[model samples]
Target: MKKEILKIALLFLSITSSSTFAQETLDAFLKDQPIIDMHFHITKGYGDNEIYRHLNVDIDSAKLYWAIEDYKKNNVVLALGGGPLKYAKMYAGAERLFWSGLIFPCTKTVEQDKPCEKEFYSESELREIYQRGNFKSLGESMFNYYGIPPADKRLEPYWKIAMEYDIPIGIHADSGPPVERVNKEERPNYNPTYANPELLKPILKKYPKLKLYLMHYGGEYSDQSLNLMKEYPQIYCEISAVSMFLPKEVWEPNVKKLFSEGLGDRLMFASDYFGTVRKNIEIIYNLDWLSEEQKRDVFYNNAARFLELSDSEIREHRKKLN
Candidate 1:
């Protein structure tokens, strides 16, 4: 929890330098409403206080226990904790709080160990595993990092499984994180083309019922993101790491463009980084252009619809509206 305390201290320091986040009324507003953070991670390894370290930017880092506390503190009803199977133990008993994802066609496969292989699952076999494990979604998948687009022939059964059992999916559509100034591993295989938002067109064509979302809004491809949503009603995009890296002046306008184009309803709010949830929340909650209702849509309603939160879950979470 030291990381979280340090982050709050840093953010308190940050608000002094920049006028980019929560006012007193905004804090009250956020506390009163429930949120569904569509792109949170259970991991706490953002390795920050860099690049913008002079300004004390702590947007990308937090502690694991601290993040859970933050989620409940912020009234985040259902977080799509977008990490792989290895991270599932983090939420062992807190199943109702977040839905963890399995990284499909897993990245970082060490060829010798074959650590990322998936065995065939018969219907009954898969059902038993699903009951035992909490992989509610197949996602934060590394198509961009490994340069495998959603339409690759290998993903045929993956899509079929999602359609068959109604598992929601989230994928890495961003061009991956910018290389760090130090200790950064160069992404030799990273391909920007795989991150393009338009690439999902064919995948959706085959399975229009698929519950999928572009996790990072396609890195710098926000325009294509806008068009994809315009063309296909099935597409939803969340702005996370990309926004945290940008100055609010440059970042907020991209958001305004979606609102201006009538696509704001499908844009979900996500703080992919940890401890920066309030920063990300305030980015949407205090938007001057959006009505109170519209801001709620970005914060909660849109993701709720996209993820198909059950009526009982909705009713339970809606209690925070009071």
Candidate 2:
């Protein structure tokens, strides 16, 4: 929690050095809506060292703590959780510390000595975990990976469980070239090309009812993402980390193109805000190509529909119809 707080403080410090933003803009924009951040990460002992090494950014728990406090102060809903499923317990603990909404079926691998690992949990054990915490959705599951194909028979058990619980499953779909040329800087492993729509076609056809999120706008293979959304109303694309990292000149046109192509309603906002930049909210708000209403949908309403928040909650945060 402290880390999030410090990051916000840092953001403010950074901004002040440049120029003071109009206080009214900050207050009105935030007060007018419930900014539910659909993507965040949490874990313990999993060092932030890698971020500094690759991205040259230093992050810590104190920064994240500040971020959360600032979000709450501004009436934002922080959808927080973590994985790597090996350390699910640690992630769960961190979620509670921040009073965050958890994401289930995280990819954290559990060691036998760890509190969370036990080969597999019984139905009761699974139910107990669900009941114990406040999880906003069901996953960060990598359905498409080598050895573990998107349509792999092994995932049926996990799918069945998610269906029984009626939670949204956030799946990883790699929409890029082969991994060999990929680098540590790009986080290559996460972008498995095999997870393309051609691969997931069978899986989606079979599990037609699964509420799934295609992370990263399926990367460079965005058309495949569009097709999936067209085929399945249950499928949504999360535009979080990708938007932040991409060159704005490129993103603005692509975002406009996505809407022009009729994929607007299915696009959801997820900042992937972890121990990283907290000013993304402001950056996104100021994106020039997308009109204010489009920004509101991306940042607010789309997520509200998926999360199924109450009408009253929606009314409280609805962006005014200009």
Candidate 3:
């Protein structure tokens, strides 16, 4: 398949604009480009705050006073952020970010029950937020870390709301942090099988129209993610940290495998970056295997199509960029 899309250089935006605060200069090809990041996080507590020690920008904690501006610098027209409603409202009041529901349920375990756990919206609470038009999607759900599956009965209410409102659900169906690197005190339960994409089969059958975005490209179990997508048209995957964290040799093959399966259009881009948004975007933008157009879809079109962004909304995003 000869790759068909925009020219490489044409896809960049060479900018010295004030929007970027004079620190990051975007390539000209990406000038005023539109990208929809399907995975991002905002938490009341520290979450993957130190995943990439190589990057100069360590969030230190969940301090996000710099997050909104970071999004603007990298041309993230829209982002599906996973976190509590309280923080979502604070950040998204004027930004294009949308809350994708809670990342984890209130803790049944002692550690999670403290100052932050209760902040996760309950079913009734999410419904109220939805009613007020504050919430949009659901999950980025880290069920695996909790040793639970997507089909667990405890998650029924979330599925119900997703069906009722037609919002997409994002699941962390990827492997957890490397064993040696797993936080010392917070060694998560970290069940690999719990991240299995097949667990979503029941959910699909129950809510046929519901959209599911599997974050991390299924991590080590990408084959499972690929299989599920084959079986269920509504299933999509986000190539988040896979490109950023894995050895390119390790992760690139998986990406090639996806295109080989003809799942390119269903594939979406995500940084899940709490900082240095351009570092995340640029990696995908520069994929050796991707043509300009395929990169375009991953960055913007696929997500826009998946989210069903209205024409007006899409136009407005580009309007701001130019």
Best by TM-score: 3
lDDT per residue for candidate 1 within 1-322, as digits (tens), equals 9999999999998987565344667776776688988876554233443433233234322344456677788778778865544454455345577787555555444231123435223455445545677667666665566556767666666677777778877767666555442122433455666877778878778887887777766257778778877877877888888777866776677778877888888888888866778878876766787899998888889999988788998998877556
Give RMSD (Å) of candidate 3 vs. truth: 9.0
lDDT of 2 by residue, 262-302 (tens): 87877776656554334667666776667778777777788
Q: For each candidate in the order shown, give its overall lDDT on alpha carbons.
A: 0.68, 0.57, 0.71
The TM-score obtained by model 3 is: 0.80
| Residue pairs with backbone atoms closer than 3 Å in model 1 (clashes) | none
Clash number for every model? 0, 24, 13
Task: State the lDDT at 3 in candidate 2.
Answer: 100
Q: How do all the candidates rank in terms of TM-score, highest first? A: 3, 1, 2
Worst 10 residues of 1 by lDDT: 110-119
What TM-score does candidate 1 get on C-alpha atoms? 0.76
TM-scores for every candidate against the unseen true structure: 0.76, 0.69, 0.80
**Alpha-carbon deviation at 40 in model 2, angstroms:** 1.4
Off by over 4 Å in 3: 1-26, 45-65, 106-123, 178-181, 184-188
